[model samples]
Target: MINLNEVLKTLNDDKQQEFINYLDKKNKRKDAKNIQLVKLLLIDKYSSQEISEKIYGKQNKVALHALRKRLFQSLIDFTANTCIKEENSLDVKLIKYIIAARSFLQKEQIEVGYQILDKAKIIATEYQLFSILNEIYHTKIQYVHQYKTLNLEETICNFKENQQQLIQEDNLNIAYANIRKSLNEYQQKKTIIDIKKLIENTLKTQNISDLSLLSFKSLYQLLQITTISSSQKFDYYNLTSFATETYKIVENHTSKNKQLYYHIEILYLISNIFFRNKKFHQSLKYLQLMNFYMNENKQKYLKDFSSKHDLLLALNYNYIEKQEEAIQLLENSINKKSSNVIQNLDIYLTLIVCYFQHKNLTKAQNLLSKLYHTDKWYLEKAGLVWTIKKNLIDILLQIDSGHINLVESRLKSFKRNYFKHLKDIHQENVIAYLKLVEIYYKNPEKASSKEFYNRVETSFNFIDNKKEDIFMMSFFAWLKAKMTKQDVYLVTLELINS
Candidate 1:
């Protein structure tokens, strides 16, 4: 997870500086070292020793300790004030309204108290914040006691409605939580058989129905289930149906939805589905739509949304044969900092592949150097696909440069690593592809043989038309092109487009 200071900075640099300045003003202090400490924290490079040296010219751990405590409290106070002023976030405004209502009620300002409560109630209902609505209803009952002029019957009825809403909301929240937990488990070695059963049980147990009404959270959960099922079962039609219905739900309720982040996330999920189905044009279209949402609310989402948008859009560009555009997009985005280590690795590996495919060997080599120097902890955590892809790109670069000895050495290391880390048919298919590359390197004269093509197809017949490994589709196409003596680029394009 991203640190709090970094998340705040990503929200707004100017705002963060203003917050620091506000702290200085409140303290009536000038040139505060703690202010600089706050700045360091925002960049995620804060060190007590560095701060102590900068402040006192020697190690003073005691002073640094006091400063850290003060700075943390100052940040909390600043965030509280800032959130109250941010009208764009309904939750923030709802908090402010609730606070104001309580203060007004204590002061015997009955009209103002009721007015504030009314506003908060509207916001809570609009956002489907049933928990908050329950709080509002309980507060209303107290107000009714103080101002007897209010109708008790109406207040009691509203309270009952809120109680019913709370029950429904609780049920939905629990169902969604369970589904997310199962998805996390599915990311491990667990198969889709158990996951599919879990989904069915959740829907029946929760009384979730396609024909009935649903909340935004429930609808999003449904889409997630459909996405996983579609990928595991290769059922694109069900994915399309669910995704389309989810899109319509978002559109229909856009006005009242406070969780607009879901809209962007759903677009990403839909775009990925299309990409996996090899519908590049449709995938690009949805990505464009996702970009429009990100741009429209850039300040609130730019830092979070930009990285994912660049990655998927670049991938679509790569598949469409717009290599320069793909390379440019990935290169620009890869140099920036991100909180997600796994995502960062994905972007770097994708960029390396794009550079290799674009024939920019020098650029690819530069990225490879960075990967080699990266922390081994990250490399280990990046999982099997990353390790295999990185080594393959290295081998491909060697093949392109005609370094046969280097290629042979790397191939030996690659096979060793693959067998040690991966135990699946996918691993075997990838190693087979690498071996095929080695064969071509050793015997270029056999490339155009029809017999060679037949043998190559038979060698990896188990992996043919297997949608589980979309990452290898282009490589398979390149191998096929080699055997048929066709343009590698054209064959790759045809494979993805097919």
Candidate 2:
């Protein structure tokens, strides 16, 4: 008979080694059925997902959540089930072991802890406490101590030294800098071919195409630079073309790399450009693409992120006048998150405004009450943008535009105050409102009393709206209706010729 073992071992040594390593890692996982009380007691001690995974073997997030919930729900049951606590009895021996272990760990004395464990193991295999202590000493303590001393000042000093050490030969950072400057200059005057060429050549030389794993750190820095530079100089066509070209290349050749954030940045750029170009569908398309990758990334990685994408999604939908859709998206974003108050506050404020716009003042007031308790939410509520939003909501739902007398009485401040903070992006819609003021000053008859019947005509040419003329006509009619007692519907203007 043939030896089965020999027959099965015919694979090459390289493949065999790889398989062995994989099995070793797989074997280290905790049993799915394994329920340990001690592990739960020490749960708070095991910080970070990666360390928890390493210590527990294979763990699902659901299990961790369930474990915590069970502990809180029934503390006595939690104390009873753990074998480590039962034998050790939380007695002086166990307490002494824990204290010594904690001390050894704090002092980075891993060898001392390991030696203690070995001696304890000789006394009895029942010393499971030693195993936990040893894991803590080796992984947590050793890992933490490898960085530096425990003081903040010393840590800062160490950080600066490390930073200086890394500053050498960062040619990628230099190239990223040049690429951004070129992009900005190109937008301002519509040409930066030579700089673009340099960027293209750098990519070629670095072989940053096809199978080469891209650098996420570099990508984030480059994206940030692009955003800052773009703000300094706005370029519509050239920026869009450049972004589109880059997207095609990256999407086809090297999308598998750590690219979720970069993809989001690219989509944002495209959507903003499309918005400026009066292409609502196109803008929504790019924004949806951004949502797609963001969701994908959230599924794949345990990123250190707060759930703030809801705010962005809501804002985009609101810009396109999809109020209900925006509110739903915000609700979904905040439903399950455990913390990140600042981000949640942002979501809440935006959601409240959306609801207010739809004439749901009761719901908006409820959110405002919740915000009163949340400190960060207060700043956002008292900010300049919130004031404009409040008035817009009042007009959209409660106030009439046709009664010019009524509108003048109600919106007297808005009509007369002349808001001056037009330099901020947060004032985008507000700036459009300011433009209406200027347009009305030159042509007062164009400013209608009925907001619904009165359409937003040629007040601002920059807003992205596919139904531009109709909206302008209807809004002006609506404004006129709100202003004057009679209907004042106007004719729609055709699209501006390119």
For model 2, the stretches where C-alpha displacement exceeds 4 angstroms are 1-216, 228-239, 252-255, 259-298, 302-323, 337-342, 368-498
Model 2 per-residue lDDT tens digits across residues 82-121: 3354324433454466457557756878656545534543
- Candidate 2 global lDDT: 0.47
Candidate 1 lowest-lDDT run of ten? 184-193
Best by TM-score: 1
Q: What TM-score quantifies how close candidate 2 is to the native fold?
A: 0.39
TM-score of each prediction: 0.77, 0.39
lDDT values for all models:
0.71, 0.47
